[model samples]
Target: MASGEERYQEFAPPPALRPFVRTIWTYAAPDPSRTIQRIAPDGCPELVFDLGAPYAEQGEDGVFRLQPPALFAGQMTRPLVMHPTGPTELVAVRFEPDGARDFLGFPLSAATDRRLDMVERLAGFAPPPGDPAGQVAAFVAWLEDQRRRTVWWIDPVVRAEITAAETEAPAPTPASARAASAQRALQRRFADRVGVSPRLLRSIFRFRRVFDHAAHPGEDVEGWLEAGLQAGYFDQPQMARDFRRFLGCTATDWARDQHALARAIASQARVAS
Candidate 1:
């Protein structure tokens, strides 16, 4: 089996493309003859565009399978969504919470099936012959066009209207001084539109955010524990409980898994690029 780093190396996105989107990546079959099994974990909502011939996706239940036509984006809760062992290439977009909200016409708090027909239409596109640069240019144009449409379709217009109706709608106060202001914005925005308060979102967000630090490979968990305290977790026990609840593992296990994957991706990315 290929390590996560191996998989990442095979599919790392071009460095030049990172600024345009959050971690856009492409994964291709590792060997021309062998199939690659992809296990996608529960994560931020994402869009996947197929660049090769269409392929099969095993449903969550595993009893059913389907061929995804070209472009699709939705909530992914399982580990193995696409088990493509054949020749295939994909472009994946992982959106930020607010960006996801603006892009999907829904909140990131829920798993949804959002299919943009235009994406598939564009995926069916054929890049000009002979120039790899031309093909990528064409694909980038289609991607930007869809991104513009998605942003236009959804913004906090409805939420803004509701906030306007309530006379006391607290003017977007800065979140508590104890918590990072950005964290507070994530909490408030999620609560207003997603129906869950930021406190709840923080439990999940913090669990994930620790990864930002933990991915460093040598950072001690003690520092993370202390950071959690600063981030407003009542205590280490409280933080650990939340990790088990949302991430399905203890902090140590979660950090290790992500670290492993990060290492794998970083190493493989060099070769893939």
Candidate 2:
């Protein structure tokens, strides 16, 4: 089996697609030793094209079922546990936080935490036929066509809220009687476009930051408590709460668990960035 870094690769989207597309990535591991991996939420939706054996995802009821060969994964609120049934080869597009709706032509909230058959749900959309690189090229061309046909727009207030959440800024305080109305409007716009409320997005971002700290500790960092503080948590207990809610495990337990594929992809992404 190839090493994780060698098995996975990421490519940049074209300049024209940068506003909507975060990245296009490929993963190929024909004989992986570690099969199961827990993938935590990252606030972005994805379009996945499986060129090799399909993966199986574990449901809340603990049953594992095969995933569709081509699928659109919506904004996820919880971790997704999955394992490849055979050889694994995939090409995927990761969209910006509020980008998927423009292409799908529906409110994003409808697909939250769900994976839909791409060709079935998306009229006139099909995976390009070719090797991974050729398929990516074809896919990019298709996206360019879609871009030309669609009118692109994002609510300014929702855009600002996404920025604030990513930066871990404190929630804004209502200044007047109309503030409540304005806040509701923001929430509606955000949910329709981004598939989650601003507060939940903020929490997810903070949780991911803390997880990153755990995955790659600095030389001066002492422990998880310090990591939590660095990640904007009030204390260790608060961090623990977030870990339980997002990962279904305590920080210590999660650290002890080996999620080889997930960890490797995350490390590669950090390096690429």
> Which numbered prediction scores highest in TM-score against the true structure?
2
lDDT of 2 by residue, 155-259 (tens): 666777677778777545432444687878877887899999887888888888777644553423357677678778998788888877777776555555635
Highest lDDT scorer? 2
After superposition on all C-alphas, the RMSD of every candidate to the true structure, in Å, is: 8.7, 3.2
Each prediction's whole-model lDDT (CA): 0.46, 0.75
TM-score of each: 0.52, 0.86
For model 1, residues 1-273, the per-residue Cα lDDT tens digits are 242222332222344333234455555443433332333222344555565545555564665354564543543322333344445455556543334554445555554433333354554576553333454566566666666665433235434422332222433433454468666665556543433443343344444444344334555768878777765567888877755555445556544554223334333432332
Question: How well does candidate 2 match the true structure in TM-score terms?
Answer: 0.86
In candidate 1, what residue range of length 10 has the lowest lDDT sum?
3-12
Candidate 1 stretches greater than 4 Å from native:
1-23, 27-44, 51-89, 101-139, 147-171, 174-197, 214-221, 254-273
